[model samples]
Target chain A: MTAALMDGTAVARRSLDDTRTRVSAYRETTGRTPRLATVLVGDDPASHTYVRMKVNRCRQVGIDSLRRDLPAESTTAQVVATVDELVADESVDGILVQHPMPGHIDERAVFDAISRGKDVDGVTANAFLDMANGHEETFASCTPAGIVALLDAYDVPLSGKHVVVIGRSSILGKPAALMLLGRDATVTICHSKTRGLAQFVSEADIVVAAVGRPELIRGEWIKPGAVVIDAGYNEGNVGDVAFGPAAERARLITPVPGGVGPMTIAMLLAQTVSAAEQRES
Target chain B: MTAALMDGTAVARRSLDDTRTRVSAYRETTGRTPRLATVLVGDDPASHTYVRMKVNRCRQVGIDSLRRDLPAESTTAQVVATVDELVADESVDGILVQHPMPGHIDERAVFDAISRGKDVDGVTANAFLDMANGHEETFASCTPAGIVALLDAYDVPLSGKHVVVIGRSSILGKPAALMLLGRDATVTICHSKTRGLAQFVSEADIVVAAVGRPELIRGEWIKPGAVVIDAGYNEGNVGDVAFGPAAERARLITPVPGGVGPMTIAMLLAQTVSAAEQRES
Candidate 1:
């Protein structure tokens, strides 16, 4: 049986539309548009493209974008200083420090430098603690938050469901598991070190493949009628799930390009507006 | 087949002996005793007993104890102010605000007020994040750290093992699961909202019962040869697991009173000395 598609593109569009309205209302009330400051480091083409797309989304939602681009040779202290300035700047409602900021630079130090209130990207340790503790107002990592939004948009049940998240990165798998657990779903976190991974996947009522490996989660491992959310976007647009075969078994499945990608930016935009509204309160 | 006991009492004695050595060495080098400042809000008998026990351990290990007892009528702001003093005071090497403060006081606010470096009890959000991210130098919640130390002392291999943690409280279950996952164990976190709890428990290689309810994890649900770590401390010395029946099938098990209790105090003393050493460095 062919599975129904979880149309994240449509969901993200609706989210951004809501964000646009909020932005308009915020501007009317405070006489200032919500602004998101982004830090882009090095010359990675993909990173540049991602920042540009985010800035473009800011414009579409009636928000202002402040871009701080740094060279490949920039030190951790410089990036942290830039973030410190944004944290002190009352005009910047949200801050996003694009990840993978050169190998030599400490990414965590810079992420921690972002103010908790302005941490729209939700990369800070303080932000993570808030989310882990089930604080509804706390910002979450974009991809994980987007996955939750997508699930909620489709009215998928999370409570008491066994969710096997196939990754354990702090930004993606770990936070996703914590968020799912917070929603009362029984959550299992598996990583490269996990033994008998296929057996774990087979038992999951909801399977979330966040490992970046292309088609790492075999389609045959999916339980029939399970809800599959593939947060992976590997090279060549391939996902971690063997999409075709898994779609045949899954009750609902999210497609690669249109699935998690759009929802991520939508959450980012939504969170930026939320931060602005918070300032007024 | 009867399961072997994990012997937390013996292990804790060894650990405390080591802490005493460290405390002496730290004192010799720094010309000051390692100090643990504990804030006990209200006069709850249990909390007072716990604080007195911890202070006793501090003296046993050659560390100094500073006690701050506040009235039951204390507001959240007052509790936070008390913590703030300890955070700013250089003489206090570690700070611990006993849990379950007066219902009126915001426990989290007081926990957050402690400086991260001095949060020896590991109740702060910053410390939780550090533990979640597997930072080696960061402090961890005492009870959870004690459980890990017990497992290590018993030579229980954690890598690739399926660990089912029953509970989601910030201090115990959640951090314990994160620490196990850091050690390469595939971790599943289940709580009150979880469905089919028995099935999940039966599949685990290691079962950790941190839920305070006595005998909530039934003996029949335990997998044969599985390691059982019960962290529950309930009335009449009963634990979350049905110990007598569980020991019949388990490979290794920890007793309720003698198991997790002593190890907790040992970890607190060790962390206090560690904090003192950090100051010396």
Candidate 2:
């Protein structure tokens, strides 16, 4: 592959290192470590795994992680109450509520109850809109913000460039598109409803594939010199883009497992540290 | 013209009539008139004119208008203080802040201070995002929400349609695009930074011209049978689209003067009435 692989792992490590240093300083100054309340509902295997990774990462960065595991049958009221308690906890600097809650639970309502200042996961509607409005804030949706961080670290040009985001999800696709627009990029959001998605992708200077479907974006559809970021995590550990061929055509490409995954947790921890710092000051 | 003209005026009038009825009902139920606190910073003539239109409209609809006119040199803290008092006031059912506040004032800070329940203008970050997240709550930004209302009134199909929104302002273009995306339209947002704007406009099934540049979108660029919405207000009362040519090509188009302008005030009044109704009930 002639393309330069965008190394998300290395960048994430650097970010983690910086977060670790600041976290140490925060603990020393505040006399208490920053704590992240990780709330996972149900026994979904994937959710369990993600929560474990985030908790472990928090510990690695010298930040404390508080685990709140609820039963699969937890009601919406129970979830909201749990989040409300976390919001009231002065010791908790950040909160992450795992997604895909039980069918009976109302996800939005629970997320809405999280305190905006302590929303390190960027789940609150206020936080989401702030980022969308291009307002300066310490927190943003982890994945989208991480993707932007990757682009920034790699020095990918955003000003006036054409960015085709292949999703319209509130968390991932929508936020990412808005962030790019804030950077003055001409952004086009293509969802499943979009016609001729490939045609749009083929013309974009930067393509962000986030449709969740595994390998939905064929490599041939990528522009010859474009930068490709795959933010999808699907079955069999596959990404939205056909990475092998996409790597060949793209001037820069982010791999599935090592790319956006690590960056998300890193940013979450960093935001947690920031929230702690802001609170202490 | 062969194209069916989207009569924003008639639709807006209908909305206003409905809002008027609701305001009257709210006044009777609450034993007080539905009150809107209009906050205006500085002495800009245009801002004054717009505020006058809104206050007069509120009076016509049987709603009480409380004007809070601050000096041009008002500090951000002063503006925020005024808004907070209005937010806490039992009589104020809705809050409308005129735009283009003095350069020293932080507009976002003042807007955020308005109670979400009473945010009739929908300029608050929370309201902007609620619409973006497709959550059913209160209101949306007046202009964008008005555009959506017009589309719904005209029965313009959005499902799986290509909607190219030519602007990215948080209050206008960005929010409009997100609302369209929520409606299942594949949305693309282009701004001044977008290269070859005409190319994107030409391919769209629906084009929302919100660039604020007069006649920026030529008529020939509009796809045959497409729906065009011009949300631009430029000098001499012109719209962003070249109307004559655009109307000739598109199946539907909104006239500049009678189009988005009236609908904005209509939506604002409608939202104000809605806030009063919800508050009363």
Candidate 3:
């Protein structure tokens, strides 16, 4: 491959290490560790695994985690009440809700209930607007924040570049585009209804494929010398981009398994500590 | 001019008439007039004029107006306190806050304070998320909402259409792009940093120019048979697009003085009555 692999796994590790140091220092000064309250509303095995990993990482980094597991049949009111309790909890520095809740429950209402002060996952509307409007004290949504952290760590300049983001999910694609726009990149958001999607992708200096469909963006669609971030992780460890062919055209490309995945937890922990700092001040 | 002119003045009048009917029906059934609270911070003459026009529009539509004009020296805390009072008042169905608050004031803080139920202007984070996510009930920001209303009124199809929106202001360009995306359009947001802005503009089926730079989008760059919405109202009645040349190429174009300008207040009133309808239900 002519392109260099963007080492997201290594970058996420360094970020976690820095966060560990900050957590240690914060605990030393404040006489308490930053705590994250994780609320899981369903028994989805994937969510269970993800939450366990996050909680374990928190423990390793000198942060405390409180796990709240609700049944799959739990009502929307029940989930919201649980989050509201966490919001009122003085000891909780942040709250993370494992998404894809039961379809019967109102997920958006629950996401809306997470307070801005404790929204480490950055799923709330308040946090989204703050980040989009370029407020200094904003907390970013985890995956989008991780994407940016990776881009910055790799010395990819955003200002004046053409960045095309494919997908429009609330937590990932939409917020990622907003955050990119805040940093001064010209951002275009394409979805299922878009005409000439390949032509739009080929013109981009950076392409962020967050659409969950596997290998939707072909190698020929990628602009040569472009930076590629495959934000999708479908079955069989595949990303939205055909990595082998895309890598040949891309100057820098992030692999699916090791890339955007690890950065989400890293950002969650870091933002949690940052939230604690803000609370202390 | 070969292009069909999209008349915003007539469209806004129709919208106001619809809102007027709703307000009158609401009053007849409930025995109380719907009310809108307009909060104007600082003594900027332009803001004073805009708010006056809005209150007058409210009067014309049989809605009562509560005007809170704070002095230029008002603190952010003070402004927020005023909004909180309005939020608690059951008689006030909607609240509108004039923009460009004094440099010393934290405008976002005040915006966050306005309750979602009464955020008629849709400046709050919660309202932005609702509209962006395609939720059923939403109060869109006035100008962005106005743009969509104009398009729908003129029977412009958004599905599978390529829409290039120039400018990325938090309340205008970005929100307009999101609203279009919610309607299943392929929306691209280009800003000052966008390279080859003309090239991007030329590829779209629908072009929304909101850059506020007069005549920045040249006529030759406009694709033939495209729908153009010139949202910029700069000095001397000029728009962002070179209107004369663009009009020759476009299938439909909104004029500067009578176009996207008048729809703002109309949307404000319509959403205010909408808030009242929800409250009564």
Docking class of 3: high
Which stretches of model 3 miss by more than 4 angstroms? none
Error of 2 at A244 (Å): 3.4
Ranking by lDDT: 1, 3, 2
Candidate 2 residue lDDT tens string, A1-281: 86898889999999999999998887687689999998999999989999999999988989998999999999999999999999999889999999979889989889888987898988877787778878767479899999999999999999989999998888899899988998999998889988888898998999999989999999999999999999999988899999999988999999888988889998899899989988877
lDDT of 1 at B102: 82
Using TM-score as the measure, what is the rank order of every candidate, best first? 1, 3, 2
TM-score of each: 0.97, 0.90, 0.96
DockQ of each: 0.84, 0.68, 0.80
In order, the Cα lDDT scores of the candidates are: 0.92, 0.89, 0.92
Instruction: Report the lDDT of model 2 for residue A110.
Output: 91
Chain A TM-score relative to the true structure, per candidate: 0.97, 0.96, 0.97
State the local distance difference test value for candidate 1: 0.92
Question: Which digits, one per residue and each the tens of the lDDT, describe model 1 over residues B14-129?
Answer: 99999999988887877899999999988899999999999999999899999999999999998889888888888899998988988888787889888878989898777888
Residue A4 lDDT in candidate 1: 94
CA shift of B203, model 1, Å = 0.7
- Fnat, model by model in order, equals 0.90, 0.84, 0.84
